[model samples]
Target: MESQSSLQRLLSGPIAPGELAWIGLRPARRASMIPVSAAKLAPGEGLEGDHYISSRNGPRQVTLIAAEDLAAIGQFLAGAGAQPEQLRRNLVTRGVNLLALKDRRFSIGPVILEGAGECAPCGRMEETLGPGGYNAVRGHGGILARVIEGGEVRLGDPIERIEEDISTVLARRRNR
Candidate 1:
């Protein structure tokens, strides 16, 4: 069996972004999942905002942020003895490094998310997590994906690989 940490979901956001923001359960009583897409990190954007990962033909937009920045946040919070779980990232996947998934494809249930590009950190990190967070995930290849099919994704969902070998994809990028 795979380790518990190996399979998990990951959704997160700055405590506050431009126009103010917060990562919380979106309003849609029956909808457990939201479409994920790729987009530039504007001055203020997050998981629950209007641009929190959307779709071109449907109700979805890109949800993104720097992965390395997240690690930085985790590290700082860890150093200060701040409970990392308190940060409230929906899924904390391990082993299947996120940066490697850039410009690739991964399946989340029936939905296929094409890794479009990186989601860089913005000034919001400095505003929310602290000044240091802005430097945390600068170019770590944060994930930007668009959902090809809609599905239900809740907290603790496992990030499973169904088609392409993401390890190779991620490895190739790492070698670059």
Candidate 2:
């Protein structure tokens, strides 16, 4: 077994920021997502122009997938190719472990987002990726989040972790 200090050391390190690689918005349910270079996010709403805008006040206002996961999913599907739009996520990022952001706050460009939970693969994934699509995205579905501060998010924006006390963060989230 590893020592406590070793475990701490393993977890403690500079955050590896991610870059926004793609943005997509579904204007209507069961519709394909339209690619965009930039988009505006609103608190209590999702990405502007997205179908979920009117009903996305909950914790899952936005969805994100890592670029690496997309690649892995593609490989898992035997080079079937997993595109961001097909995944139906609002943002596709590179170089960040989105799962690590759960219950934490992060910033993308001028927007601040609070991680809500893991974005589990939906049944629709089968229709999107075909045959094994659902299974391929199971553990790689990325994360769900809500906008804490509204602002514009553009492609290539950096996704960074925000350092804050847990209690204070919780208190702030509760007030929102």
Candidate 3:
């Protein structure tokens, strides 16, 4: 059996906060994304002006990619750097391990987001990233999330993991 400290180390530790490096919104299906400095997120609506807002699915309200992963993808493709627009994700973050936030609620500026799952690479990756684009983005595809509390998220906002219990955070927000 693991000791208390060891268990704690495995379960909880100092959070490495990340930064919101970029934001993009697709205004229409199959359209190129437009970079934005800030955007409003809403429950069940995704980003206010994003094409995904109308998506019937709830778990895919937002998509995020780590800048580090993008760099890795670029290196994997022989210096072919992949841009945020090419990935088709809504947000690009740096320094945080997105997979670590699985099943957890986190704060990105004023917005509260619940991690849903991995945003697997789709067929479009090849068309966007070139020959091995699909394979390049295979494991670096980032994460999907649901908006828990809608609010404005701006470029350069700190992406932080919520240390408090999600229930406690939600309760406090409700009481406010």
Candidate 4:
């Protein structure tokens, strides 16, 4: 079995304009595209929603704030921690396959999500980059998920995988 340290990370783009490239410790499926009525989206408040739309036939795309990175950033800002620079993922996903999360089902806290599609970067990234943000995540798929269950998600929370190997399950279902 691969150690947790061996888990690959996916870097789609930067967090904000003028910010460094953002890396997802584990990229996940973009669920329903529904809007999560969590706390207000602030600069440092974590979660933020943009006007960009991924699927017209699907739900709205809601950007998730990685609780892990937020906690680390918050701690450093509070002067109670010492850590190196870290990549801030918009969505903190677990369990569900980071690469095959789309069109699938997963959960956070107690909420079950209906993975819709990919969260690709847009031209607005260029505005944030002031020059080359558009090219940052050209082919990379950033995560976009609709909140199935609304609950406070903090760092260290587990993104339990309902299916151990999605491909295997899917193949079996198809054969049936």
Candidate 5:
């Protein structure tokens, strides 16, 4: 019998489900984000009508931020927290730790997304949030994801991790 690796077990830890609290999309590069109640996620492309729409699929098809982190950022910035639109993430999630989703597949409503990478803060953060904006968002910037199964996601949707069996996780880790 194959023994379970501690690393794989740790990676499979359970997380409390979160909620999709907000949605925002930019029609063009450097454009102001438009808040929406619902949005369609296109597999291999991106959010419909968003500037990230493309023919090829890649990391960063979607961006997300934790609402708690937003509050933390507000506290860091002398209580002047930026809004979801100003932060420019496609989805604003609450009650879940974004860092815990790294390298895992998760779902928001019917849409599935794979953790891709960190959403690094851009130089525009300074312009968007005033002085120290870039620094303020450094660790609180959120995460990037690739759409796996595209579908419509709406505000108040539940964010749940797609748990994999221990054997499957071990096999994948071994292969890596």
Candidate 6:
């Protein structure tokens, strides 16, 4: 047995679980996102009814945003909290640091997703959220992920990190 370094321990520390607060699906490009209580996730494909689908897995198989971030975006403009659909993200989560999921494997119920990168806000935000919309979402756009294991993701499903830190993984690789 060996003692762990403080930084390593901190990186591997526990994260409080969060629940899936909302779900939205875009039926087609430029279509209004429809709020849904549940949706099916298919590996290599996106949400069953959502338009952003492909035969092969991609970085943006699905997109998610934090509920807190949405509120922050709203505060930037006249105390108007934008709706989940207005953000154009596939899911809206609450009570969790979504950045923690970046570059890590996390699970939403039985569905597994590997955080691909930051879900940068698109120019469309201006049109969707009104004035200053794009700037409002600048640092709070949430994250995008690729589905590694597919299953149903329903509202109220628990979201939890189920993997080791990427730093630990990189260290192991370097040592080997």
By lDDT, the best candidate is 3
Per-residue lDDT of candidate 1, residues 15-134 (tens digit): 111111112333343233332332122122223433243314321234433333456556754553212222322223333556545555554423345556665655655544565656
Residue 144 accuracy (lDDT) in model 5:
91
Cα-based lDDT at residue 125, candidate 1: 52
* TM-score to true structure, per model: 0.49, 0.86, 0.90, 0.42, 0.88, 0.86
Candidate 5 per-residue lDDT over residues 48-161, each given as its tens digit: 989988744788889999999889878878999888887889999999999788778888997878888889999988888889888889899899998877889999999988
Using TM-score as the measure, the top candidate is: 3
Per-model root-mean-square deviation over C-alphas: 13.7, 4.6, 2.4, 13.0, 5.5, 6.0
Q: Report the lDDT tens digits of candidate 2 across residue range 1-176.
A: 95578766655445799999999999999888899999999987879999998975898899999999999999999998999988899999999999878777898987889999999998998888999999999899999999987889999999988877645765775688
What 10-residue stretch in candidate 5 is worst by lDDT?
165-174
Off by over 4 Å in 4: 1-58, 64-90, 93-97, 164-176
CA lDDT of every candidate: 0.41, 0.89, 0.90, 0.38, 0.87, 0.87
Q: What stretches of model 6 exceed 4 Å from their correct place?
A: 1-8, 164-176
Q: After superposition, how far is residue 7 of candidate 2 from its true place, in Å?
A: 6.8
Off by over 4 Å in 3: 1-11, 171-176
- lDDT for residue 92 in candidate 3, whole number 0-100: 96
lDDT of 2: 0.89
What is the Cα-based lDDT of residue 168 in candidate 2?
72
